[model samples]
Target: MTLLDGQVWTSDIYVDGWRPGRGEPWQVREPATGNIIGRVGTATTEDVAEAAAKAAKAQHAWQNTPYDERAAVLRRAGDLWNVHSGEVQEWLIREAGSIGPKAGLETHIAAQECFEAAALPSHPMGDVLPSTEPRWSMARRRPVGVVSVIAPFNFPLILSIRSVAPALALGNAVLLKPDPRTAVCGGVTLMRVFEEAGLPPGLLQMLPGGADIGQALVTTPEVRVVSFTGSTAAGQAVGELAGKHLKRAHLELGGNNALIVLPGADLERATSAGAFGSFMHQGQICMTTGRHLVHESMHDAYVEALASTASHLPVGDPHRGEVALGPIIDEKQVARIHRIVKSTVEAGARLAAGGTFEGPFYRPTVLAQMEPSMPAYTEEVFGPVAPVVPFSSHEEAIGLARRSEYGLSLGILGDVGTAMEIADSVPSGIVHINEQTVADEANVPFGGVGASGTGSRFGGPTANIEAFTETQWLTARPQIAPYPF
Candidate 1:
């Protein structure tokens, strides 16, 4: 729905399965055109507390719900997702500023997560333990009660669903706080889908606001777990709050990922992968290849080929034809990227391809001969800019990759044995061979290490074990023993 000039649509914040919010409204703007897409209700602290208490109350009944019923609800939600995918995809493009391909991938992954989580109830729960005494002992996983999910604007659907689905599947209530910029698409849409799928009232809460709401959600005592996805600094704050309350925290934070191009690697394949890894969605992804490490033997040729490939990538309006690169999220992000590019070039790096912007659109950029001390090389440049550095030997390449504090994902292009060796040595959570650093399959764990995140995986069915569950040991005495008092 396009709003006329001076008109703004207001979307309410969901609490206790209803919109009881009367707080100030936060304006949601389309990054591509700077138009008012909608206005999301800014949840107050009281709203968060009420949501938490309601979720806790709702979880008491949900936890005891039959496994079959829970599975059916999730499956129905998945079905609804497919039915409304066209509309949801349009929302993603408009709200999150995602290109067509990126939006499709995110929507597909969100639906798949619901389907995967649907099977969590039927999966193996616990194991029996051999006991020395005349007793039977076993360990089983149980729901952690209420969980809080804080998602970022980029890939909002997938990030939120990855945690929300598992929490729901494990019979835990969820309070999701999506980035306010994407409130309608990521928050209201999810709540509607579950509600339409016969999910009980109060089982899920959707609050759209700024960091205050996120802080309130994490610090709420009734929230048993906090699953957060955003910048490293924000994740750290959430982790601290979770720790202070002794609540379980699962974090997927920022990443300055690296993609290595070896001497004998397929140049065409490497170039294509590098271009996609660096420029997709204007490189807002956490796992986007921020650094391209090339072996010195092929550094010059790789730089030229990569620059040529990146330059040809379609960049403009997301609603237009076959756009490979979309606008940066906002003016602040565009300015930050330009600053990084300018500083890197001043520090002796060469700008190979693109380094300009028209409105919010930042052309795909390549910086070669980058030193480790350069900000673009060391920091997470969350934009369509790849800083290339040359490594003379295998040891140097490994050292260069390891020098960063973020060990989220790594890509190495080489033979199988060599790739395996490099992958084994790298401290990243995900390592791809002959591929880009960014890849998210539904069945594999997706997260990071060190400052990148809290080292918790958030994908596949196993995600249920990460943030929404706790292990309990139960024992039965077969023979009664006399107690000495």
Candidate 2:
């Protein structure tokens, strides 16, 4: 009898207003105790195909509907998100063992995305081209076809609905496949919110299952666009499938972000800023500052200071209402982090601070004297472990930071001159000066490059809506145009 139980969250699959028996149910686990969160209905290959077919069949009416109609449903969906915020908050905490400020972020970010998307105009894509004043020049953004939203486990709510909602706003039907591990907490309830918003049957459906369901959705001809957020390996697979089928795919993948702290930088400011990126979600975010490149002179002092600060970060149950760090997502993740840490130690890395775990909880750990060859430094640990690698020169620090195959995110805390210089040169999508790499406000474009991800997200209303919609250049030929001049 381990910590977790066998029960799971259960939900009826909604297909054309009929609750059908989709074979095989999922056992959603509580990450902390590894107990049953609930058994959500799992979608089979056939179930997925049927759902896609239904969406394709309904696409005509769905896409033709007015933007106001679509916006109303989206706004209503936000209301529903609040209605279920309590339950969702619980799921996020249980699934990710998300603690303190991080746990609440899921609820607020999801609600913000929904509420803001709901307010977007149906036809904001206007027409203009001042360069050619005497000629007809206009641009417009139109709805793409059906989309399959495959989201990752970390920040499940933040990533999943953020992508799907905008697409829905643009009059596109969607089939969202959330990570099976987080189906109950983030996945199923998200769909319930859409349902509560009175979404037209078949306009949006959730298929919560394993890779089989994902493959089914991607390969299905009816799924015209595929938007995914997950590991780089899985992202490559999805991209390949989309390419093979000649379909549009948007991928938000993994990262091994780096944060550089120069000699003259404020140690407290750098440490505090970097802490949120790696500690929040237990460092599961792809854009988190997973690597710390400290100036050689400050290496020892910074490590000692960071270790002391990290040790004091509270650890406990997410529901306890304390500023504590919760466990990683699940048991396997717990073991994976263990192996990475062990391997890093074997490769000559030193554990500077907390590195112990009971159940799924791994106390926030700090590692130093790690080479790029070490797993913890090179690979995406996806845990609260920051590998502090020191660099002698400014050039070397920037070089080490940009040397990765990943260019997802980077940050610099130093003199304004060097920080800005590094921010400009860092080969990442988002760069922060005097701040942590992963601190993305909702209104800015957020994503990565290389193996990191293909798109971005922001905090503002427009930034929020771009994820789900595609740009379509619409033109208007004059009703009565004169002959060529």
lDDT tens digits by residue: candidate 1, 1-485: 32111123254677864554656877888888899877777688889888899899999999899999999999998888887888888888877888898888887887888898899888888899998877889998999998899999888898889889988999999999988888777787788789878999999998888888888998888988889999999999999988998987888999999898887888888888988898888899999999999988888888999999888888877865668877788899899999999998999989999998899989899998789999899889899998889998888888888989998999998777777877877799889998899889766788899989977568766666655788899899867766897
lDDT (tens digit, per residue) of candidate 2 on 87-152: 667667776567646656777777766776666654466557554434466666556678888888
Off by over 4 Å in 2: 1-11, 17-21, 126-139, 320-323, 457-485
C-alpha lDDT values of all predictions? 0.86, 0.77
In model 2, the Cα lDDT at residue 315 comes to 71
